[model samples]
Target: MREQTGLGKVARRQGAATLNPIMLARDGDSRLALYAAARDHLRARGYEQVSMRMFRAPHAPEQNGPSYCCQNDGRIAARRWPALRAALPAHIYLWLNAYDRRGPGYYSAEDLAWLDAIDPWFALNRRPVPSRGKACLAGELSLSVDGDGELARCHFIPERLGNLYTDDLADMLQERSCPRFKCDCYIGYAQRKDLPFQRVFGTGVLARIAPEQ
Candidate 1:
């Protein structure tokens, strides 16, 4: 399911006083205003850091359902890159998933090239971007736990490594190598060993935001 658009309502319901809420923005200029409004709402509520992740195709279709696939239609055109970049507020850090050997939502070679070209823009504007090329921290530094306590390597990969309620957490975490060969999700790849997450966000790389300069 897509993230709810009611930023204020979500904050209130979750008691997000100290929470850094991450809003999802679908790829396109049409939704920029909606996300910008959400960003403003969060900032007004004393949230110094609000992140926005660009929606990628659900890697777990069995869980997300077939109808949720809209990667191609939702993809932002290369020609619209400048407009999209300009429209986003500086405070809202945007994340893009690297193109990988995946389906439906997989970014094309051209898209990767576009990402290379736009890397400087993100850097110049002080926005957070992933390190170039493939990298993964899944099943290594982080783990995803479902509502039922099923533990997985990452959110994108649904293969259950173990159950939190039944299995030893330490044993479950023992396997450093991921069951999958590749990871295309930003949440998975952003924590690459080579990435400067520790230097930027400290130990709380998953939740912490880089402080403004």
Candidate 2:
């Protein structure tokens, strides 16, 4: 599968990977926070900063697809592993995550497959990072659970429930899957329009929870 626009031809290099120095950005989080978390994660692991281009995290409709955080070549936020790692210069791996499933947005197997064609290991933001939900989350249908626990299932007919955390993106992944598909996290949240939240737990506050289109 080929990418349509915005970012195209996403691929990866050959080498042993390190899931240490990571960046996860989700709703309610800021780009600054994302960078700090990534930097700290790497620093603790003995990695240093080289060239970090922390942009005003992408917003809804601004992104191209389910895995928009990846670069045209599907590298972490398009950091171009070699270049971004130049300053600190270490054979390390970085992650650019987003909100999770059961939050808002319909990330299905087919959608995930398309993302993989962009990047083999392009993971889904399965870990449900706490964030504000888009009042009008657009997708096949809204299938999610809020902090208070609310569910919206059914592509055509919708169903709402209280304390609905049963359908997590991680658990959803288990129901159906593709062998080659790779997204480390299980869930992610969509971006908020008004004000963003502050986080420091490797997500929300920092670039731990990567936001997608």
Give TM per candidate. 0.41, 0.19
Winner by lDDT: 1
**Candidate 1, 1-213: lDDT as tens digits:** 232123332333244442234431222223447666877776676554412533333232343432223342344355777567568665433454332334663555676566655543233222234333435566766788754476777765656688889998778664354444444444664556665654666655565455565
Winning model by TM-score: 1
Residue 178 of model 2, lDDT score: 18
Give the distance in Å from residue 105's predicted Cα in candidate 2 to where it truly belongs: 26
Residue-level lDDT of model 2, residues 18-137, one tens digit each, is 211222122232434665778777667654343353233223245445433333223234435334545532322244333332444545686566554443224534343233232312
Question: What residue pairs are clashing in model 1?
Answer: none
Distance from true location, Cα of 8 in model 2, Å: 30
